[model samples]
Target: MSTPSADESVELEWDDIQSGALHERPSPYVGRYVLIRIDDREAGRELVRRLLPAIEAGHPTADPARDAWITVAFTYQGLRALGVPSDSLDSFAPEFRAGMAARAAELGDVGDSDPGNWEQPLGTPAVHIALAALSPDSVRLAKVMERAQQAYGQLPGVEVIWRQDCYQLETGRTSFGFRDGIGQPAVEGTGRNTNPHEAPIKAGEFLLGYPDETGALPPMPSPDVLGRNGTYLVFRKLHTRVAAYRQYLYDQASSRAEERLLAAKTVGRWPSGAPLSLSSDQDDPELGADPDRNNRFSYHDDLDGFKCPAGAHARRANPRGALDHENSVNVRLHRMIRRSTSYGPSLPEGVREDDGADRGIVFVCVGAHLKRQFEFVKTQWLNDGIFIGAPQEADPLVGRSDTPGVFTIPRRPVRRRLRNLPPFVVTRGGEYFFVPGLRALRWLSELDS
Candidate 1:
């Protein structure tokens, strides 16, 4: 395995890092996810050896003609399945080694969302590898996936345990009716800081072996060659109850216009992705469609939560400048490279009844620290409201609690609190993984050599 030099440690190795680790998923896309389990160490290494070329060695969308990218990741058990040394294996982050199921309590995966109820093969050692291919067209996506299949199709020792195909909804919004991929943070070297309100977060916040927001190198997994350019990954299968969500909003609202306004305030953004900070009273389709101005607003002026509630899912997930007065809360440290793809068909407009069909998103989060970034957002922000000064409130849209929940919307005359907020999203299953860079893939390929 090739090891980067000291100077290279701080440099952004675009070619070495997996594109999916740093870049957002392309919109208007079709994709596939396949989970594998290795019964033989040699077979696992051989699969990696054969699949390396199929995996992109550079930026996901660097080439103008290339519209698809394939990426691979491994659970701790996967590394062990490949015969990675115990010392090196133990060096990974504690949370990762524990796996997602073990940390269910911390992630608020209780009641129906518990790990005991998670989908089969997930949260278990049966999941050794995760491979995915995403492309804007079905033909291109299938072509890439075909190459991946050839890598492990004939390997008797490698078993395909599960697979899911995802696509962009016609509405281009999440199942809950809000723009899905708005307001992603920019990484320092990646040139993602297009929004004037956002500064590129330090690279180390997302990639290993680089100086982070704290101006220090993030702690890398042991064995420099294996850890450098790698990042922790979290993928959860969240099942959204679209019908219930709509019914609740319909029940709370007296009219269709009020219903739309209620939904926008809940997500801090309009159905078209327009942020409430810019258009508080109404949905601005033009502003929501503009990439330049949609995500340009801030919470500094709306600290009182009149425009956008402090407890809105988006606001709580990313406070931006809203928490500046606290001084102790640094939003950058908790930021991660998050992307998701929708599975199942979008619930048709004006329908509020259960279709009895499974539909939701497969959320993929990439970052250097699982505990601080992904888990922190899940527990401290999404599942708890202490950070936003609403201790009793969780994220109104996605928050999961046993008792009846309350969502506060600060407004003129009187503050409105929506009570009995149900868990609109349920955890189907998930796992923690380490997505290694191109060089690290080579390292895994030769593990049995």
Candidate 2:
């Protein structure tokens, strides 16, 4: 396979694609995710028809209308529930058809994170549709949410099962106290190249109907209108133990400075979002605030893991320039568009006792290939660490460490290893959905009824 070429130019049909594909979410925004089930085929189809007019094409971040809009996707069972033909449904990727719940073992969602323990309607086949609405302010969000509710409010056989309202806190940190939504990839066609070190990835890596990093078009699901401009989405609700995380860090460190450093090494970034690769010794709030410089550093130079440990969460998630030495490792192929938000309330600072309030993050990822992009990262990088030369260790933050695991941090004269690492993030519930294009929405609504 060839690397993404900067010389390549392809104009995409922005009007047909979902707006989230090109959406650059604003900081301090509020959003809601709703899960629905379909009992009657006509009702499901009618729900799509009503939502079609509301979900328009991609819009710029500056566009006021961009703040308030809804986007929808369907599960494998959802397609069948909508009366889609067998051949078309079968054409979808096998992992997607099997559902995230079925592939839990492969994703290392074992022990307490198992699917059996997942939230109701999330892992079940009843979850047919997923709707997401976003806005910078609550008023705008309410306007669109009202429209979204009216879209399926009275539709018989179409029931809204579960919903999660999430947002970025005033501190701009997740429940875990790290800045979220950094290191976003720039698509080749979009004029949003933020990272100066790397060229824009191929457009097909995230959207269908274009050449991906492998120099070929990604596999699309059946009829052109249904899959051409569409892509797959992975939505997850993770339950974080904020008190446990805070106490663990406190116990591991002797002073406040050491505590901050330990947190940075664990996540590969400071609470301000400055990458350890650039600011290794101390936290740099100014660098983290600068969009152009914060995400520009790479791990290739820190091969010995002195600056940023190989097993750190950010490095393991995206090795970037570090994997060039590996023969079969193509970091670009495993990339996914990540846009996650925090749910529940942010645990107050310095509070080490369990509050019992359910709080964490709602992760949203978009890609054309489910198995390669989303699943590959979860299985290979997060769940296991063989690629980074540590087989026993998993992601220190989210990995489901059934038995106590170890996290290695390389130092000057001697390396430091944190042992008996317990799982910090638990899987509350999650699902996979096919986020279709505007034309595909029309195609789905107009299906034989």
Candidate 3:
């Protein structure tokens, strides 16, 4: 096996992340979940052995100690084959929620459940677990994922094999409201990432050995390519600064909820897919529903930064045309199929202004390489302020500054443009993981046994 040199790797570049053939169409398979790192992987294995029967009986993982975060499971192929009923998804959702609520109670009070202020003038972006807390339970959770994958692999007739589905700490806005997963790359071969007809997975810098020449490879690669097609899962728990966000909006709002909503519109999308680019004053439900229309439009058409400001959360997360005309299409390929859910709760009504509460989203990204996809976006774009010296520093929505050089999202107001857009999110904890394929899972189970 030949390895590319450091310089060689750097030189390799894809026109867009999705510049090749797609292994599969982007589906709901990308469910977000959070794996609690337990103290011992063996201990977790032991618990899994005991819990298998119980989980089969429709109970949560029997391992009590391993339950720490509410995991979002993506796709049903594996579980369904294990005799898990296809119709049970909606029914099982509550069970999943119950499991999460129970786990949250064990961890700590994330926050209150008031969804009122979200519509108010200004509020700090709501805090929810974008990542899971560091604990011994994480080990157990990792083993659980391994076991689950292995168990599913044994079942019959699974078409598209999944290497791993991202687990995240359950987090999101109040009930009944949709949270849009924006900045998606079009199907690689489908013209979303690159020129139409190219495969989604490009080679160079995608996985370990594959170069960009081949284009988009299968999401779950053949075992021979990487020895184990287990892609890396980047786990990050981002704490949204709720109070600060609320204060900002409340301070700026005039009369109606629409004014406050407009502030949010500047960021694009109302937690839902509503496009502020087209409907800046109010969220257009119709536009939000259409993925073709919503994900396709950008602020580049109106360079004044009114439709979607350069600093807006959506625009910043995905600069699209702001970076360069074709840049959005190309870079969108790198976008991870996110399956994040909100965790924690809204701030209580009368907890005093200074009272501290913890809340955020458990952000998880499943990709071939943590460095190329997650780390590159985080360090170079999201966390790095003054990227290419264009706009402000760092993404105000979810960027964080930890110990200066390690990672810094410097808070700088938009110069000669919009005023006083503070940093609204912070990173509390994070880790990188390798989610293995089902075959790999069986291999690990054998090792564990």
The whole-model C-alpha lDDT of candidate 1 against the native structure comes to 0.86
The best candidate by TM-score is 2
TM-score of each: 0.96, 0.97, 0.54
2: Cα error in model 3, Å: 41
In the range 1-449, model 3's lDDT, one tens digit per residue, is: 12212222222212212111122212221232323222233433333343232121112222323342222222222222223233442332221212222322222212321122121111111111122222123465455455444533333332121112332223234221335455543222222342122124443223322433334433333334212333444444555666666665566566558445645544556645676667766777687767556665655675546555555556656665566654434554455544343445556532325346556655655655444466556655665546435433545555443222111122235423333555555544433443333333333333322
Q: Kindly report which residue pairs in candidate 2 clash with one another.
A: none
| Full-model lDDT for every candidate | 0.86, 0.86, 0.39
Q: On residues 1-449, what C-alpha lDDT tens digit does candidate 2 reach at each position?
A: 13234644788888898887567666678999999999999999999988987786964455534466677899999999999889899888898899999998898888888988888978899999999988888999999888888899988899999999988886789998898888888788776665555778898998888899999999988888888889889988899988988888888889999988988999999988899999999999999999878887888899988999998999989998898977679999999888788889988989999889999999889999999998999999988988888998999998865778789999978888888877789998888899999988888888993
Q: How far is candidate 2 from the true structure (C-alpha RMSD, Å)?
A: 2.3
Predicted structure 2: lDDT: 0.86
Q: Superposing all C-alpha atoms, what RMSD in Å does each candidate have to the true structure?
A: 4.4, 2.3, 15.1
Task: Give the runs in model 2 whose Cα sits over 4 Å from its true position.
Answer: 1-8, 62-66
The alpha-carbon lDDT assigned to residue 105 of candidate 3 equals 21
Arranged by TM-score with the best first, the candidates are 2, 1, 3
